[model samples]
Target: MIGIIGGSGVYRAEMLEDCKKEEIATPYGRVSLTVGSFDGKKIAFIARHGEKHSVPPHMVNYRAHIKAFEILGVERVIATAAVGSLRDDYVPGNIVVPDQFIDFTKKREYTFYDREAVHISMADPFCDEMRAISFKVLKDFEHKEKGTYVCIEGPRFSTRAESRMFKSFGDIIGMTLVPECQLARELGMCYLCLAMVTDYDVYGEKPVSNVDVKRVMAENIERIQRVIEQMLKELPEGRSCRCSRALEEAR
Candidate 1:
């Protein structure tokens, strides 16, 4: 089954007919999930920010969410995130399927391999197979197919100086994505992050603020919802990539 992870508004479980909620327990913690059929295909949908958007980015249980999908037999996961733009090329209201990620998250549990030493290769953080499929579905829109996302540890927005420093390293800025991306790979699941630019961080004339981020998210989430719906309908029956074998050589 294909898994879709996003905010409550972006990935609606009510959109599915005969929907049912299921909770799974992982070694890390518990993950609440909803499973139903969309377009006659079985799909597992979960909110990245908890059911009511109560969890902050830094407090999210990345391990539990990804592990729940793995235990439930999901082959691939498509995640939608609201991020801040660090580059002039990517502006608010634009969508981007991040091809790479830079982990700057300081105080979050980043791996499931605490007991064992597993050196996993992260040459490409996001799944190439899913990225290709996302491009096809969002071709009509002005979206970026490739960009580097810098993940920060935050319940707070970035300062002007910190934001400026990150501009040199990445194309976008966000508070999540680190452990979520890595954990999926460790479990041999195909993961893709579909990011929506929500603000210009501190790079813009006005320093980034929660108000602006929420405003931009409100404007662009519907568009993301439509794009994701179409992508789910067009996914191939089999994935032809190395995402599923990520643990083969590493373990």
Candidate 2:
């Protein structure tokens, strides 16, 4: 099975066939998601932010969503996030499949093993196979094959000074992806983030706005959907990446 975790501007799984709304009970809370199929692969999708974009990034229930996918037997996950570009060249309307991430988030659960010591490796945070497949499928699009994501704790955009600091080492900036990505690794689930650039961060001397982010994402939503669809059709059934073995050495 496959999973799609939709972030800002992505509220539904319109590509899934025979879709049905499902609500699952998890240790954290109940999670609402849609279940369907495409290309014979069962898909489960949940909006990272609530459907109406009411849930702020810092307040997202990262655990319950991952737990819901686990309960539904989802193996690989493709998540979408709208981000601000840290560099001038990584312009809006482009897609970046991040190979690394720097977690700057605070006050969120970073792991599921709070009761025990389980240190999972995040050296290469994303699933390599999924990254490779995404690169291939998005070849024709204006996409970056690799980049570093800086996930911040936010209900607000960054200050100019803060944006400049992040620009020193990150390619893109967003409010989600930390605990969500790491938690998936703890459960040995293959995860990938398809980050879409919405605007220039304040480091570029242009202030970020919710209006601009929504506009960019709204224009390119179809492109994102097509990329996921192609990936679903190309994804193999066997497990070959280290993602499924993520917890083998974690103790």
Summing lDDT over every window of 10 consecutive residues in candidate 1, give the lowest-scoring window: 7-16
lDDT of 2 by residue, 164-221 (tens): 8999999999999899999999999999999999999786656999999999999999
Worst 10 residues of 2 by lDDT: 201-210
* lDDT (C-alpha, whole model) for all candidates: 0.85, 0.93
- Residue by residue across 40-59, what tens digits does model 1's lDDT show? 78889989887778888888
Report model 2's TM-score to 2 decimal places: 0.99
Indicate the residue-level lDDT of 129 in model 2: 94
> All candidates: CA RMSD in angstroms?
1.4, 0.7
Can you tell me which runs of candidate 2 are displaced by over 4 Å? Answer: none
> Residue 79 in model 2: shift from native, Å?
0.2
Q: Against the true structure, whose lDDT is highest?
A: 2
Clashing pairs in 1: none
